[model samples]
Target: MSTSTIFHRVAFIIGGGSNVGMHVAQKLKTEGYRVAFGSRNPDIATLEQKELFPVSVDASNPESIKSAFDLVRTNLGEPSIVVHNVGIHFQPPVRNDPFSVSSDTFAKSCNIQLALFVAVQETLASFRSDKSTTPKVFIGTGNGLPFLKNMPPFFLALASQKATMYTMMDYASRAYAPEGFRFHYATLVGPDGGLPNLDPSAEVGFYNSGPAHAKAFWNLISADVAKSWDYRFTYAGEPLMT
Candidate 1:
């Protein structure tokens, strides 16, 4: 390959202002890949890298997503890869039991997870061209536990929603592979991996422990990203092909 030949590499990160999304953007920027970081609040998109394009995006809205994609196309051209890091998990709606799960709570959990799914779907549909050497979609999974575990009431809702989203992701990957759209799912289980220390809960001893476990998991995530483009691994289990 000639040095002057542009690789046309770009990564669009949903919820890019904080958490794993920011870390992933940093990693990609370090490797010389163009990064478009999206946040519901545009002010949150912050990074020192000149190549990083921080934009406002509402993951749940199709029009908002299209606008983000359009902006990227105009400024950075079609992204070679897309990473969705938008999902919320808090102790709120404090579930007492499965039987107590409310319709409103369930909808909130599902909506949050489904938003990422819609973003990925729209992104895949917007690929300017199918003729590229590197074309992939990395959808970050917020629920990292195995499929069989009995999660807390709120988490049960979260996990089921993630599973449903992954099912769609699998079909989309299979459906689009012939046309050069590749979809990959990754479970981002951690409390800290280069997110700004804005939340005091993140500094607490108990909250920090989960992320400590997640830190080791990130090593696996690095290896997974490097070793294979498509595969699935439970946060607590061995690697398996998607």
Candidate 2:
């Protein structure tokens, strides 16, 4: 029997209704992984994609997360993978500085990222209940440079959370390695949403971040490994740091 067989494996994705989350879910469905996505509105997943189950989840509320995970567990089996793609982008574009962002908003941002840790714990607990032997994967989509490096002004919440999550993933990657769990943090260059100082035309050849990263993740999980390999990947989905 092959050590890797992804058919019908479950993936619980947070915020998988639209944007990059939608793209990732589409890719995973194509690869034959049963996907249950959590978003505010379950209605976003239409009749077209019958296999994708959408559950209502409020990213900021811990109770909502618990409920969502419980729903996923009851509906589909324990998930073989968990994708933390939830984030609250600052509205109105905060190009200025700290004065622009209120403490309440930052608190919400912190909660958004902190939810991943909670989800990861609950996910593992679910898997452990049945003593599942299948290797599990946790994937977190990140932004900007990790706070350890440089913090972009516009990405205040993102940088702060990304840095902490990076450290969390690093620790989990090591602690869970021997038990056959894999963790990955990927910082992807998203679609040309027409950001400042960037020409949309110049991105003609750039890899589509969502689908590309999804494929990269699937490939990683399919490959046989003694321990968790490559804790991070680049925007181009390259595992090597170059």
Candidate 3:
């Protein structure tokens, strides 16, 4: 695969119906990529008007994800870029009590990691089969929870799952680097280089800006392959190896 070859610029974004996912999709569409937004319930009318494709997907279900990928391939060609933006987080029933978390809740939260693994496998298979020179990139959206030593007790399940997800993606980045594929776990932080406020309605700072994340993702995709294997990056697109 060489850069000179012509191929469709297709992107598949999991959990792309709202928030950061929609922002990334819009950015890619503006960059001339055919974008597919995948969620449990897709807003087809809005997506069609934006010239974006919509596919129904349940991130916790591997079969649903596989079907979504198939639909993208059939509608927009093999996606050279795949973004996994789905995650699970919930406050414990008994705040500040880690043990108050139920087994079923923890199991359900961890299942997103399994979904990410399946998405990665599907992306790699698609990349291996495509001969285009476009960058083959898979990005997993993350946050600062994984790095905190004293994580909030209510966030125990989320912290554990994110740490595991980070490890899995880091391994994938190294394992597939020889083949020119890029795997990145983007950790979004506040503008002042601190943890972002997790409240959806919080207007803490610029780090919460969807466009900023979109730009960071675009930068990662446009980076030189030689410098793109760092496995993790900050919201500013700076590599974070440690």
Candidate 4:
């Protein structure tokens, strides 16, 4: 399916309250997509937007995710593009001690991984039902943790979850490629392959901003079919075929 034909199609974004999610949603809206923002507490401004639909969703709950997709389908038709931008990141109380992290916190990370699995299943079902020739794209956001060999001890849980997510996306991309479904896992990192810097004063070259992420996502979605099968890539759309 060509980008021109899918301009007016529907796009559903999970975790749309995040900075990167909001930028991607705006990009899709500007490109003529009927955008649906799924978050636990959507911003009032987003809910008021004309072509943007804000649906409440809990990223850790499978039922909540399904319900949110249902609402999107009811209001904006089936989503041809689905983005799983939900993630959990926090430091252990003892900073460098991975064992200091509570079991509940680790469980929360597991729940998020399960949620992504559910979201991917929901997207696949939606695409199978829709008869339109529009692109069936699913983008999963990640960081450098999954690919790192010496990850920080305090980020153990997050690293584990990200590794699982990367594996899942890899499988999905290969399994669904023949069906015309594109599954991409985008790693948002610096040009030198460093993690994102949240500090506003950080050097521009060392940080990957929300707008950069948005642009990378758009590039993935608009990529030609021959290039679409490349699942893992950097925030700048550079392929990491490994």
Candidate 5:
């Protein structure tokens, strides 16, 4: 990005330490937008010379989240974009039946997702100025009700919470669209074993077909974005795009 384009707009990315969040940050930065990455691990925060700020934030704690936003506002100006992507998936080692699931595990997952939506709204309300500069929120998916098929009904607490947050997000978008806040969600059908513009041949255990699937999924979603429809849960274990 040229010096003239640097800091033209700003974005706040939650869970921006690794993977998709990091890729999002790189994309935004390449486009000349200032970015701030929020995470519990400050040490691993993605770095930029001046346009990126690494903030220590526990997404599950409201106060910590609030403080992180305050720091971002004080340090990076108003961020127009917010991407929320924080979650966990545990196997049998963590699960002990629906009744036996520890409150901490359940609440942590639920609260983090909920807190992200709340934090974004609060941050937008607090940081936005009268002069608009392209505001958008792109949340990572995997919480839709359709993704819960064949699973125990009780296992849906996290999904339920995510659905509620997205519902709230929809309302916020409609209510605040005049103010320039746009909301979007991206759902992943499976893991991203390799990244775009990388050497897949050197990637160990990488599915030879994974990159094709990723590109296809992105293309399908981009087409969805063009048509301006709310992409919802899957049908029969297939993504809505499929």
Candidate 6:
């Protein structure tokens, strides 16, 4: 260990302008981690940090992600954590036409929600390079609509992509855990089954407060050992997976 080396734990939050993303960033800062969040839109990405960094990154584009990580490495050192919070949605059709998957919807979901290929490539490059410490990676997600029964057609298209994402995340967590990396896929269930199969009447759910979700996520990231918190769903700080 050279005294010249500076170790500042950094966490980058993608889509960090969202309600959930903002809270997550705030929480990470409180936990003493340098944070950066990327947004596609400049308007919402306006949030700046005196000590932290923010950049423009299109989740779909590997070049954009690579560029952002490059800057992070230069400015903040290799990121010890990466949280993918980007999301995409399509409005449900009116009470008439059946739900149809549009090419636009499919592509946008791949770009935003799944964040396709670039996301994983950059994560391994940045986090896996330094094996002396454990690197944490978490993807914020919602309950898979496709796997659930009795869902409305309005969600058909979105469900297809999200379900695929869930499965892929599962595989990633399993494959990477064998190494010294911590990979997590936390699916949130909000009020009124907001994202998936949830009872509208259930109180004390994940939506109880935005900070609660952030706290739970932080707990997973800061855990002493990587538990099965990855590949799990949580509601109000409770892990749904045993």
Q: Per-residue alpha-carbon lDDT of model 6 for 1-242, expressed as tens digits?
A: 23245456878877666557778878888888777777776443246534446767887666787888886777666777887765455654453233555666556666554454567667778876655464466564545464557766666555666666666667777878777676666766543334533343546544343565686677778778875634344556555543
RMSD of each: 6.7, 5.5, 4.2, 4.4, 6.8, 4.4
Worst ten-residue run, lDDT, model 4?
Answer: 226-235
- Clashes counted in candidate 3 amount to 0
What lDDT does model 4 reach? 0.78
Pairs of residues at least 3 apart in sequence or in different chains that clash in candidate 5: none
Which lDDT tens digits does candidate 2 get at residues 32-60? Answer: 77788888877743813566877889877
Q: List the residue pairs that clash in candidate 6.
A: none
TM-score of candidate 3 against the unseen true structure: 0.88
In candidate 5, stretches whose alpha carbon ends up further than 4 angstroms from where it belongs are 1-8, 44-46, 49-51, 90-96, 138-148, 152-157, 190-229, 232-242
Error of 3 at 228 (Å): 5.8
Per-residue lDDT of 80-147 in model 3, one digit per residue for the tens? 99998877776788899977888888877777777777898899988987888988888888776776
**Model 4 agreement with the true structure over 1-242: per-residue lDDT tens digits:** 23334334899999975567888898988887889888898875846655577789999888899898888777777899999887777689999999788998888888888888899999998899788887889988777787766877988888877787788888999999889998877876654566655576865522436777788788888877535432444545456434
Of 4 and 5, which scores higher on TM-score? 4
Q: Once superposed on the true structure, which residue ranges of model 1 sit more than 4 Å away at CA?
A: 1-7, 48-50, 90-94, 98-105, 128-130, 188-242
Tens-digit lDDT string for candidate 1 (122-236): 5765564635655455555434433435455555655666676667667776777677555655543323321222355755332233332233224333443343333444323
What's the lDDT for candidate 2? 0.66
Per-prediction count of colliding residue pairs? 0, 0, 0, 0, 0, 0
How well does candidate 1 score on lDDT at residue 107?
74
The TM-score values for the models, in the order shown, are: 0.68, 0.80, 0.88, 0.88, 0.68, 0.79
Error of 2 at 90 (Å): 2.2
**All candidates' lDDT scores?**
0.57, 0.66, 0.78, 0.78, 0.55, 0.64
